[model samples]
Target: MIAANVSSSHGEKPRKPPVKVLSSQLREGKGSAVGGGKPEVSIRRLGSRRPGSSGSLAVSVVWMQGTVLEAHTDQNSALLLDETGNFHITGVKNIPRGKPCLSPGKYVMVMGVIQSHSPEPVLRAVKMADLSHNAAMHRKMWKYEVEDLQQTLPS
Candidate 1:
């Protein structure tokens, strides 16, 4: 006759296994942790590819938290400065002719879709806001390009 052995501890606490989930639920939108989808706003540079677009707007490579000196435009170009450094490029595109290009030292809010290609970062300015007095990290968002600019300038 063969002897049978029985287990001493029957149902000890079962070991908990790992659970996998989507990264969007994570706190930082990273890994498997849960998070909220909140749009991020930052002071960054902008670049335009098709300046002729009637609706879309384009700006320059903005360097955040830097000084933009009021420099004179010699040949239909505006110069800007920011944390990244100095940039001399064409003024905002798709504005009525002779509209005074935005001056330096005028706080501005830039909004648009962010795009990265190869080794560069650019934002297609869907909207822009002037902020000169309020000294905050972010600025108030403005209306869409066509509706806003059209109202400001003469037709």
Candidate 2:
């Protein structure tokens, strides 16, 4: 099984590095969204996987960046708006110690797995980092980086 730990804490089990993907690539089934290497997939793609397929039971770790549209601290969830669409993220309180707080209008980076795809795509966050300090620059840079990776990386 592919472990999906993003933390560097010692004594923990080994984990796979997350694949960075764009919300659009995830939604449209375009770009480098397949292969024998890392699992690059969207919520729809993940939901389509049948049992017994390769990595079917493995963790599908992904890294994404978006802006917080709304935060429901009481429910430990929030609405994240990426470039193409909005994603419902849960387990807000799971962020590691010293991470920035999640709040509306704040740009943040989320590392998580797709939890569901029925009503909508939901990301079960394991870690989150506030990037509001350099939102504009960071967003642009992230866009270019993802695009470049999608083109160069094998599917």
Candidate 3:
């Protein structure tokens, strides 16, 4: 059975694992968060991709946390404010029901891919969670964790 299974699999192509990346290293196309590499990044660096540049970073998945500056439920989008800058988040309509609300002043964590980087960077959220219950604590911890990861990276 083992020999047969191995022979059958040999004809199929192996799938490439998704590349993990940090926001700062997105352009450089570095490692992922689970691998002890820089995972999260500031909003300002999310739009670093230059037009016409080709790489996995162009569509690299990212995890970002910020406060909602404004929400347009009718439009299914929101304005997210982070320490570095503001980011446009779309696909709010896709968030699962009973999750946290996307109101102004609410802290949220968004996991998504970069949809575009034209006039501004837009993040098409695949998942979202409200962090307002303990926003301060979460923000501080995230800051420290990112700093530590940055230090471990090669200078």
Candidate 4:
């Protein structure tokens, strides 16, 4: 449902938001509900397509906090959705390992390297902290997290 009211080709007419549907959803007819029309989808990942191709191996570390929108996991790897994007996190290190340690709707703080810089950037999470799934608690946590993050910035 996230979209911008962009100007159309015919001048000034507000364009509709582009809806992206997962393949499974499309198969299940979920893609047809957007404004009673078929939703458009792109095959490639949504983010910066290229990383730094320069000779410099400089990797910048940063932190992000967002509600978990989606999650996927295997025996060795895990993915969790965030505002920037779904991050591919190393499942073994600094993560609470057990059945359902992370799930949809959990708030989390992740520290990682930006693999790409798109609106939904991909990050390789090095460490993470669970900020609880409660909205009130998460908001309180955000205040503290922001304050801590602010101190790290060169002001």
Candidate 5:
């Protein structure tokens, strides 16, 4: 069980790290052991109240190595890359309502929940913010499946 302490309220009192449950385990009541009580799930876990999440389990997404490959201001969008390759983030879909512009050359920190709908996992950005310039730590890693990437990218 991997656990890390983070202040989810973004304040003083620390909350327990969100647990990552196997989808099958969740379906089979395997998470009944976490809280020493019944598994108390928030929107970030498996609650149904949060919008744009479709009432499914949410997982934290942390992507650190990315470059802006494409920018579409008219659509308010950008493509990002990492060791795993490129992914799309669109203002129309990824950004929350009434959000600001996402410029090029900016290192973005996306705090969202991931949902797997089959072949790929989709990140639903709930809290998108910019990382401080010095906070970025880049490292070279192995390449991803290029042919598989070509299928997912926009033409």
Candidate 6:
């Protein structure tokens, strides 16, 4: 099995923006996002591809936690950071009321769906959360994931 880190940190939380992955290089089940304030969900980067059950038009739900390395929100759509890669989120709720703007460098929990076969999949977020308040938990998750990845790597 392949593996990847789930959470991320740089000593303290990243003050600058998170990393931005070129959409062209991502494989599957990668990306991060969040909105408003909600409980954090344990999510990690995916290392295996789940074959599209039927054929095309397959949607996979992905839960991810990471910093928003970059973001741009219009009236109805936004793109969140690059844990493994960036995500283009559409039809997301909780616009932060007034500004409807979210800054980079904010930690978040993202649950979205992606087309299993799309090379550059856009994560249509269904649920999102601000996990910055629980920085310790997110950082600890990174350690566990790294351990998990090590175990999965081939000798």
* Superposition TM-score, candidate 2 onto the true structure: 0.66
Candidate-wise lDDT, in order: 0.31, 0.64, 0.56, 0.43, 0.38, 0.45
Tens-place lDDT per residue, model 3, 15-88, is 22222223334333332342334243222222223445322332335566778888997898888766656778
**For candidate 4, what is the TM-score?**
0.43
lDDT tens per residue, model 4, 1-155: 22346475775556443222112211222111123342322122222223432211112334556656556555444555543245444442445542254566767666654444333345556566667646566645554544333332221
The C-alpha TM-scores of every prediction are 0.29, 0.66, 0.58, 0.43, 0.38, 0.45
List the lowest-lDDT window of 10 residues for candidate 4.
24-33
Predict model 5's lDDT versus the native.
Answer: 0.38
Each candidate: RMSD? 25.0, 8.3, 11.0, 17.4, 13.7, 13.5
TM-score of 1: 0.29
Task: List, in order, the clash count of every candidate structure.
Answer: 9, 1, 1, 1, 0, 1
Model 4: how far residue 25 lies from native, Å = 30
* Residues 14-116 of candidate 5: C-alpha lDDT, one tens digit per residue: 5443332222222222122133232322222222233342333322332223455566657655555444445555442456631443556655554433332
Question: Least accurate stretch of 10 residues (summed lDDT) in model 2?
Answer: 42-51
Candidates 2 and 6 compared: the better one by TM-score is 2
lDDT of the structure predicted as candidate 4:
0.43
Best model per lDDT: 2
lDDT of model 3, residue 113: 66
Give the per-residue lDDT of model 1 (tens digit) for 1-155.
Answer: 11123233567433212111111111112111112322222211122322443322121122122223553445444444433334333334533431243577765443333232112233333334455566344322221222333223221
List candidate 4 segments past 4 Å from native: 1-59, 75-100, 133-135, 140-144
* Model 6 per-residue lDDT tens digits across residues 1-155: 54233343665432211221223323532333333322112222234423432111111345445566556555555655543455566555543431233457766766665533134446556567777788567845754553344234432
Estimate, for each residue in 44-97, the C-alpha lDDT of model 2 and write its tens digit. Answer: 222233444432222256778998888887798988888878777888877774
Q: lDDT score, residue 66, model 2?
A: 91
Q: Superposing every Cα of model 4 onto the true structure, what RMSD results?
A: 17.4
What ordering of candidates by lDDT runs from best to worst?
2, 3, 6, 4, 5, 1
